[model samples]
Target: MTDDTNCIEVVTLTPLAQRFSYRCRTPLPEPGCRVHVPFGRGERIAIVTGSSPCPEGVQIKDVRTVLDQQPLLPKALQALLEFGSNYYHYPLGGAWATALPARLCQGEPLPTPKPELWKLRSDATLPQSGWGLRQSELLQRLRRGNLRMTELGSGDRQRIRQFLAAGWIEAARESPRLHETPLTLRPEQQQAVAAIRAACGFQPFLLDGVTSSGKTEVYLQSMEPLLLAGKQVLLLVPEIALIGQTYERCVQRFGATAVAVYHSGQGDAERLRVWERARSGSLSILLGTRSALFVPLARPGLLIVDEEHDPSYKQQSGWLYSARDLGLRRAQLEELPIVLASATPALESLYNRQCGRYADLRLRERASAQNIPQIEILPLRKKRLLGGLDPSLLSACAETLASGQQALFFLNRRGYAPALLCHDCGHVPHCRRCSAPLTWHRRQARLRCHHCGWEAPVPQRCPSCGGDGMNGIGMGTEGLEQFLQERFPNIPILRVDRDEVHTPRQLAERLQAIRSTRPAILLGTQMLSKGHHFPDVTLVGIVDVDQGLYSADFRAGERLAQTVIQVAGRSGRGDAPGRVLLQSHLPEHPLLLALQSGDYGTAAAQLLRERQQAGLPPLRALALLQAEAQRVEPVYAFLHAAQEYFQGSLDCSGPVPALLERRAGFHRAYLWLESTSRPLLQQVLGASMPQIPSLPGARRVRWSLDVDPQNF
Candidate 1:
């Protein structure tokens, strides 16, 4: 083999579904390191995957500079990425791009952690006569004890660097200091923690705990041993909003230096720093959202997915992968333990427990001496609501506030109203780019489409009929907040939602404000529902329970139940008695009646039975081959042509319009594939997927395949 034609395999940050071959000189960079390579008359950064022998008579481009001296990702993390790519049927390059931080993908220099402390080397003897006075003094201080580099003068720091090069001094590793003691665990919590701590390898446990049942405490205690033994822990939450409070709690238990938080909301440099520290085994614990699942853990000991059932754990776009499922695979690969903690576990998780794949650890009672919240349904049989609140619910909130406790109103809509209705013409203004109606944002005086992000000014008159009567049709958190403020003018009404709180600092401040204002009214979309602890929030009012009563998706019931239970969980967490009033038009609905029992297990079991009977997920394997384009015909034409390649004993439905047929100026459609056996489905997909892009209609539309998809 010619030395100049040595073949190397690389993957670039592109949507292409395969790796490329490049020829470079000998001594190539190891797999997982970033490399600059020539492509299409330009240079692009790529990741070195492996090497293969050059094909005879086949010309290839040369590799440019190697970005890192060593592999950026650890071996185990690389494996996880590869496994996720294959399982999700996404492109390998795209998978790598998603796994790595944006700066790394752009060929930015790998972050090098600066040492904080310095000490004298073991064998170094003081140069009594040859060294300068400042150097001698610095060495004397170092000999006494490790000194922080930050605490030294500039002259001393420069001298210390010289001593480091001369092998007279070395970097010192500081141990993490414990700032707080562990809280006393309940009996069930102790059992759960013991089970987790005693596990040897490759164990998956479902920490099924109710609201305020101390699941976090169990996680803390379970992680203590591993952290003390010099092992790292990974904790995944479902929301960016939750990271601030969770990080604070972890910092209180473990010192601030020992804990770090990563999410998309942070700056690129900050994320890269945390990634490097975790890869170097210096960070003791990492808490983050879904994207942090790919972060490299040098000493992987335990992985915990808080609120594992959350749909936020599933990536809805780009790479369709579930962090919860991938975390399980990661733990199995690293031979460690993983805990999936949730009050309302997903049906799939419960099924896995039933199938003996995961150990079930349950916490049935509240950790606090407070009683469980009383749940009731308020029937809305043509009852007029004051800005979407049932009178009974309003009275309950008033009573709770009268008792010196807080009340929360849960509304999953953010704007002032769901739509701008032309009352005179009986016509509602819809988004021109999508099939959905534009939401009315009264505060901003704009009509916004939540689906396509299309916005327009509120019409002074009906555009279609030239009518003057245009009004908001339905209630949202913003409108509800306004009405509540008018009703309880003296009381504080805080709105917690995406528009109100944008950063971790803002969220922290808002939460602190909530804590300070007792007997306050909190209202927001689902942003306030996940894992927020308000000890004084004794009442939770689910503003519109009927919104989710009917849906086209099969998992709608499960999602609805989970949302109700999760929102209801936010109340009655303190010493005072708690209550939840789910205002519904259909109070007699089977799902609502089932939820009235306050037993998610029972509701989940019923939903599972329905799913099994309907041949849906947890009992069947499913994937969606979706296509979208500017025109409707191209989407259908592409999907129809793509459907002909499938060879399987499986059900292939669609070439049908999506639930939202139009979104963001694209006409969307999909092909649904389902099978009884997962391996057989994979086999069919593996054979057919390669031929999809080559079809004649493929170029007219953008298409992707989503395995185990959560969204319709």
Candidate 2:
């Protein structure tokens, strides 16, 4: 037998499942350590997953170098990575690469910040002249005493910078104490907080509260104990915009140093800093988007997912992991409590509560005893449209403005027009690469494809028939914004959408602007629907609600109902009663009727029953095996092989075209794997995935397996 030192071999994790062993000149490193090792003739950053004795007379190469002084991933995270790899049937190394930030995977150095607190100079005094009304009031407050330089707003910053440049003000550095007073929670919020705190280990609590019901206050209160005990809290918001909003609240309650924000929109260095802080126990609270679920907390105490039912929680690509689901899993694994707060929870989550998997905590009454929004469904099937706004909606907007309240016009689509059609030829402009129509962006003078992001200058004449006249086929936010601007020229109109609010900073700025101006009209897509507090908005206009009534996707109706209720709920948040006008072709639809009546519970129950009868999710688990190839045959052929490989363990269906079959030059197809039992589906996938790589044209195709898929 060889000596123990001589037996040392470097086993590197490859994109493939099998770990290849190499000779180690130095001692074998621990698992999770990044090593520079020879792969063929070149070197690669290979993570050491294991080490084993080589076979007799088998030649091996030595590791070139160790990339890190310590293991980048901890043991628990390593296990989670392994679980993701096996469950998704993806390459182990590829899965690990996906779990880490791109900067870390690329071996970038972490950032070092020399934080210096800035204080108002002794010579500095508040400006007494040449200021806007708002700026003048703010300066008057500052005249009482010197404040932190960082505490000023953009407007204040500009004024201060001007003052400093003119020698009217000065700057100084001093250590500043971070402090904030806790806001008082209403009785219902207090009760909700009490119930959440009472729940001990591995409990799932659903905090059912309307907008401005003080859910955030309750969350903060429940988190205080965890923070005091030196434990970390994971706070997940639906979108990056919400991340900033939630982070601001956390900062208000727990100071800026105590909270770190994480999301894709942040710089790599910022993400790395936050990651390190969370892992090192410097950050007690992490406010982030969906990916924050993977952040390594030194001592995790609580997991909170605000707006738990938001579709943004479901990742559309890569591993397709649902952050909401992963949050609950992490809580269970760590034996910690988790809270899912939502005004309208997804039917699946509601079912979990019904089945006793989650403790239901209800905040039935609004914090300030504000009444629910009064909803009115305007039947437009037999009515003539005036710029997609009915008389009732127009009159309501006029009335709302007359009463000195804000009005919101919610249109889900975002372009100038959804499609451009030739009136004579009955033909519409379409994207060459994607199986979708090109939308008209009149402001940009372009035809854009939303799906594949392809764009081109809009042609003045129709390409199909060389006709000079072409008409926009459908209305979008741009059209609504223009129409509203024309109709209510005297009223200030703010349009919020992906196009208008391109960044988190922009979204925050616009939100701040809207809050400051209470009598403005807000028009946009789903961005105005959820997680925002608009106390002054007393009117909501849903431009169209018929899109989901006949949608092909099974969950469309449910999502539509949730979105409508959420948008409408934004109204009537203050003292005066509010009103919502829903324009729909199918005014008598059951879902619309339920939503108009503010009966989400009844709607959710009905949806759950339908889902159960149809063998949908929550009753039956699903895994989607999707394949894409340049040629359609390869996709179908591979899916058929996978279907055969699964055999009897799981029910297989579809070698059918995906929702959008041809996208960005690839033909896509999917195979649905269904099983009442997760273990059975897991077993089937475990057996079948091994045979996929050897299938014909496998190298030319890309594929992914989505377990418990939220969308198809």
Report, for every candidate in turn, its global Cα lDDT versus the true structure. 0.87, 0.79
Off by over 4 Å in 1: 1-5, 127-145, 153-156, 647-649
lDDT of 2 by residue, 1-712 (tens): 3333533333344456667676666766777777777787676666777767766666766677766666677776777767767876767777666666777766565444332223345665645567788656555655565556567778877776665676654443231133576677778788878887787889899998866677888898888877877788999999887776677788787777678888899887778888877776667888888888888888888899999998888878766768798778778777889999998999889988999988888877776566776579999987888898898889889989988899999999989999999987988988888888999999999999998899999988888899977989889999888988899889889889999999988999999988888578998888889888888999999988787888767788789879988998888888888788999888889888877776577788888888899998878888888899888888988888878776577888887788888898788988888999978878878887777788766776898788877775
Residue 5, candidate 2: how far off, in angstroms? 6.0
Q: Which candidate leads the pack in TM-score?
A: 1
Report the error of model 1 at residue 268, Å: 1.4
Candidate 1 residue 555 Cα shift, in angstroms, is 1.3
Q: After aligning candidate 1 to the native by TM-score, how far in Å is the CA of 455 from where it should be?
A: 1.1
Q: Global CA lDDT of candidate 2, please? A: 0.79
What is the TM-score of candidate 1? Answer: 0.96
Off by over 4 Å in 2: 1-16, 55-57, 109-181
